[model samples]
Target: MRDLYERAITAGGLHVTEGSKLWEAYREYEMAILTINDGNDEEKAKQVQRVRALFHRQLSVPLADIESTLAAYKSWEAEEGNTRDPDSQVDDVPPNVLSAYKKASEMYNARKQYEDELSVVAESEANKLQVFLKYIKFEKSFGDPARVQVLYERAVSELPVSSDLWMGYTSYLDRTLKVPAILKSVYHRATRNCTWVSDLWVHYLLSLERIRASEDELRHVFELAIQCSFPSMNEYLNIYLTRVDSLRRRMPTGLDFELIRQTFVDAAEFLSPQLGIEELLLLHAYWAKLECNIGKDIAAARGVWENALKKSGSVLEVWQHYISMEIERGHTHEARSLYKRCYSKKFAGSGSEAVCHAWIRFEREHGTLDDYDLAIKRSPLV
Candidate 1:
């Protein structure tokens, strides 16, 4: 009964409490419903009689109190010739009822004020600071960097520490923004002080590279990023490898591949056992990329799949990527052999197994006969 009563109040967004006007009003309405439906059935009549008894037991004032209050209000109105008068005696509504009314009223007013402030902010684009903030929000939502430079130039003088503002402005400088002079400024101010926000440095580096950052600048960015705070070693590693794509032209004669190799060693050591599916797979892809780009070392590329297999032997995508890369390089034998290793491992179901079979077909279609024969030899059916 208590639970039912509580549920009723909760459903109406009211509280069951002493001196609650909402509860009192609801109780009156419920009692009136019983009064109207009292003769429906013998069972229902008894239930209504019980509800009437319970209502009076729970309520301090009787239904007559409401009637008396209403009659007094009518008499007072008749005498004063007005519905409301300061001198008229009226029953006080509960504080909870007034509080609920005030809260609803305030929420509506606050929403209006927020909308008005938003409109004023939008209209005050003549103000450079507001315009800069607008550009940051725009870039954040749409990623269109057209006005980044203009907004940055306008806002940077006043809002120097605003990272989003600076990011927008930096987006405008073209290749000039990537140079050591500019990068040094961003690193000194933003990355160094706020070591926890590693993405800021990563974004800044990418921004400069978008403007045509030199190989030296890319390397410098990586160095500084690693030196600052990398919240997760895998996160920093992925950032380093993603830039390797843009740094491809610089990798051979321009980039110090030896330095990259050392960094890879450091990252692998830090991340290998501690990695999850996404991070582990990304690490493998980075390894394949490094080998493909720098050393053209097939063994290095093969090692990525082998290491991934040791960790997550069931990940069909990892095997697929390895097979694809090998077939692309015309290493049919290696692709077949890896496929053999994958086939030996039992996956959970036929649906899971289908992906591996599809990749084998893809590899066979792309590679030589020596591959299929090797796969046949490794199979149990042979």
Candidate 2:
């Protein structure tokens, strides 16, 4: 029976209050034991100590009926002849115990204010979220881990689809607790509840990587994330980026180089059709850079850029970025050839003018005086 009560009170999320029905029942059980051991002095003394201990435990917690419980404790002490003066009952308690009770009572009162506000905002999710956030802040600063967790559970239960609440809870677990199983559990639930949130998926992937989860597990999560309907194409892009980054970090020996390259290729193929020209070009640029830096395959990088140019060759941005990549890689001859190709293409509005200016600047920086003079002569403005 005692074990049952202990388990209930200390359960992962149970919040037992002082002077509640459970406390009352526990105290009555102890009193009944005292009655049963009336004739045996040793047994009676043990029961008496048990009752005293129960009272002390009850008094330590703050509850609405705490004063009544204290009064009852004092009366019991007086009847047992443990107190010299019934009127000085407060004096019978130790200074630290009394101080602890007082502090608990004050904290309870402060917490009640937040609870009241929460009750009033029950119909408004936005307001309720605010209240929960404030309440969580209070608990984090003044309460124990269990209390904070209980509050988070409550908040998420009421706002199951709220990405903000899920993010906060998962972040707290990741940052403060660092318990892998618990973090994994919470993250799993968070992603399930907030499936549309790419950030949550990204964080989940990162968390799994942090704990060294198996590759199959990480791939399962990544697949689940890509299947969700995120609000923006960039969200999809971010998820792909996080997956690639995880693979890179996990395999420093370049064992996963082909897999990483395949992921970029997959991202480009999957995202290109859904993205605007600018976004498509951005994706290609990222893929090309990855090929150059990590795969050490400049030809493959150029292939990625060539694919982008096929899709958006008229977009000056694509040509400019391709030229810039070549320049950055010290492929000066390739950059000059790209500039010549760009100038040969017929551009609308000031696109041709922009290319002319870029070519002149490039010649000045990387070409001889003859090349610079020739570029100046070829400029339409000149």
lDDT of 2 by residue, 253-356 (tens): 44568888898889988998788876777678877888888889999999988988888888888998999999999998999889888886777788999999
CA error at residue 227 for candidate 2, angstroms: 0.7
- Backbone clashes, each candidate: 2, 0
Poorly placed runs, candidate 1 (over 4 Å): 1-161, 175-183, 207-220, 230-234, 252-256, 348-352, 359-382
Per-residue lDDT of model 1, residues 1-382, tens digit only: 4466555443332111122454455555555665577556986556555544433333322121333433443453354344454343332423443344345445334334333444466545345456556544553454423223333443554455566555544444433445556555655565654555666777766766665766677767777776765667666766666555555655655666666566566666766777777777777777677777687776877786777777777777677778778777877667666666677666666634564555457557865676556555555544
TM-scores of all models? 0.50, 0.81
Instruction: Provide the global lDDT of candidate 1 against the true structure.
Output: 0.56
Query: Relative to the unseen true structure, what is the Cα RMSD of model 1?
Result: 24.4
